[model samples]
Target: MNQNQEIRNQLIKLLEGGIAYQPIEELLKDITADEAGKSISHLPYTIWQLLEHMRITLYDILEFCQNPDYQYLKWPDDYWPKEVAPADQETLDKCIAEIKTGIQTMIKLVQDPANDLFKTFSHGEGQTLMREALLVAEHTAYHTGEVIVLRRLLGTWE
Candidate 1:
């Protein structure tokens, strides 16, 4: 395959949780709201918070990449969930859907040859498509690992 195809595959792999660590699917499966809310000693954020943060940040980056007029949420404040616990099962399902949708969008963007991966966005900051894709992948991987660790601490990891 060509370079763009190769890059697209790698990005998809990151979202699918196949390479580098456990898949988000595997990590998140069967986790109850209570389980997601529990925090180990000294851990600031719960699994719910982490999942919401991941969804928020992924949308922010994806919007920035897609829209020139995109407005970012305030750092730290807007990126994380205000509550440590999940509202309900419906909320959890929504967050997961949004994250998955954002990942699919990013994958399509990366796969499209018409879009210049290296071309920088002409907005507040000079960010390129390639840079943003890699950023989301790295960020997701980091938090996914954190979630795994938190699960182990909570005695929830299988």
Candidate 2:
């Protein structure tokens, strides 16, 4: 395999693994909407909020990577969810589905030989395709770990 392919594989592995510990699926599995909304005394957000934030950020980054005309969200505000928990089970399910879809799309984007991974975007400052991909992967992993910790703190993790 070439260097680009190898990097793509590594990114995929990063997304598939738990953020240095448990798998994302393992952490997320069997988590109910109520459990996701549970909050600690000091923490600012719940698992559901964290998950929504992650989904939104990752989606934005993916759009930035793919769309030159993409407009970013208002800093710190639009990046977070308005609700602490999902309104219904279907919303939570859809959030998870969108996150997974974003990851899959990112994997496909990096895997493609047509895209020059190191080339900077013509319309932007000095951002490359690889930089955005890695940023999304890293950000996702950080929040994924947070979600797991929140679950444990809320006594929802099994």
Candidate 3:
């Protein structure tokens, strides 16, 4: 593969997870709504909040990368869910699906040769598609780790 293809492959791997990091798609699977809502004593946000934050942040970053008309979300408010746990199983499943969907979208962007990964976005200061993909991967990995630890605390991890 050429350099651009090589870079895109590496990025797709990173976004898909399981290289030097746990896969959020795998980690998120099998978590119940109750488990998602439960908060450990020290951690301020529950799994639901964490997952929502991941979804919202991913959407924001993806929008920034693709949308010249991108609008900024409010810090902490727009990025986080108000509910500790989802209202029901459907809500929980949707959140997980959204996270996975966002990752897939990121992968598509990286895979597209037309997207010039190194070219900076006109809407932002020095942000490139490469940088945004890395940002999404890093952010999701960070929270996916937290979800694992939280699951262990909640006695849900097998």
Candidate 4:
């Protein structure tokens, strides 16, 4: 593999998680909508909020990567979920499905040699494909860890 392919591989690994942290897949497994909404009184967010936020933010970054006509999403407000949790099992399942698809989409982006990984977007402020991928990885890992803490508190992680 050339340097770029090597970098792409590394980026894919980062996006997949499970290195020095729990994979989102593992953390998210067995989580129910009810359990996702259960918030510790002192905590500002529930697990569902975190998962939804991750889905939204990752989608935003993926759009930014490909879309020249991308519009800015209002920060904090647009990035977060209005609902504390999914309304039902189907809703939660859909959220998880979208999250996984977004990850795969990002991986496909990275794997494409036509996309210069280090090339900054013309619409972005010094943001490159690599930077956006890393951002997704970092952001997902941070929130995934929080979910783990929550599950432990809920005594749900098996």
Candidate 5:
């Protein structure tokens, strides 16, 4: 495989493994009593909040990749949805599933040979398809790390 394909494959593995290995269920299994709902000292976001935020961010990136005319937005400070808080195991699982689907869709889009990897699309200044693909990987991995940290703090890592 060429450099771009190699990078894309590596990223897919990283993201897939990150989500697969995460103890999301354990962490949110009993969030009300698990202390996961409580704020941590160093991190500003809770495990639940981070998952939701990451999902939204990845979805936005995918949207931009799929639709060049889509307007991208900054990560809002008040971005969490009040109605769908990750307060329970079921909601957390749903969020994970959604994120996994988004990641898969992004990978599929990038893997399409007909799609121009170097074609510029509308992002802040405009980014090539390859650049956007790499950005998705980078962004997902970063947030996945944060999720791992939160899991650790909640004593859910396994």
Candidate 6:
């Protein structure tokens, strides 16, 4: 595999491990369903919301990379979910699936030599595909750490 493919594969492995090793499912398998949501830290975000945020950002970046003409937009200044919580198992599962799909699509695009990795995309921040992928990986890992921390705080970690 080439450099891009190798990096993509490593990123996929990181994501897969991060999602699968969710403390709630792996470590705290004995915890009751009702108590699974409570955390000592009372994180600003529930696991569900964090997943949603990660998914949305990943999708946005991948979309930008795939479509050169895509318009760029800034994230809202004060955007937090005020309604129902998205931390439920179903939402988390869906987000995981969507994130996986987005990653795969991005990897395929990057693997194509016809696609210019150095070509600048209009991310408002003026990011290139290479830079975007690295940023995505870093962002994903950061959130993955949050997920693990939340799980541990909630006593759901294995």
TM-score of each: 0.92, 0.92, 0.96, 0.96, 0.74, 0.70
Count clashing residue pairs per candidate: 0, 0, 0, 0, 0, 3
Would you list the C-alpha lDDT of every candidate in the order shown?
0.83, 0.83, 0.90, 0.89, 0.66, 0.61
Q: What is the C-alpha lDDT profile of model 6 across 55-81, one tens digit per residue? A: 778887887787767765565522333
RMSD of 3: 1.0
Candidate 3 whole-model C-alpha lDDT, 0 to 1: 0.90
Candidate 6 clash total?
Answer: 3
lDDT per residue as tens, model 5, 94-145: 7777877887887788777777777787454667767776776677667667
What tens digits encode model 3's per-residue C-alpha lDDT throughout 1-158? 79899999999999988888667767888988988999899889998989889988999998998899999888978888888999998998998999899999999999999999999899899999999999998999999998889999999896
- Residue 135 of model 2, lDDT score: 88
Worst 10 residues of 6 by lDDT: 23-32
Query: Once model 4 is optimally superposed onto the true structure by TM-score, how far is the C-alpha of residue 101 displaced, in angstroms?
Result: 0.7
Error of 6 at 92 (Å): 2.7
Which regions of candidate 5 fall more than 4 Å away from where they truly are?
Answer: 1-36, 78-87, 122-124
lDDT of 1 by residue, 66-150 (tens): 8889887898898998899888888887887787788788888887888888888988477898889889888888887788889
Off by over 4 Å in 6: 1-42, 77-80, 122-125
Q: Give the TM-score of candidate 6.
A: 0.70
Lowest-sum lDDT 10-residue window in model 1: 14-23
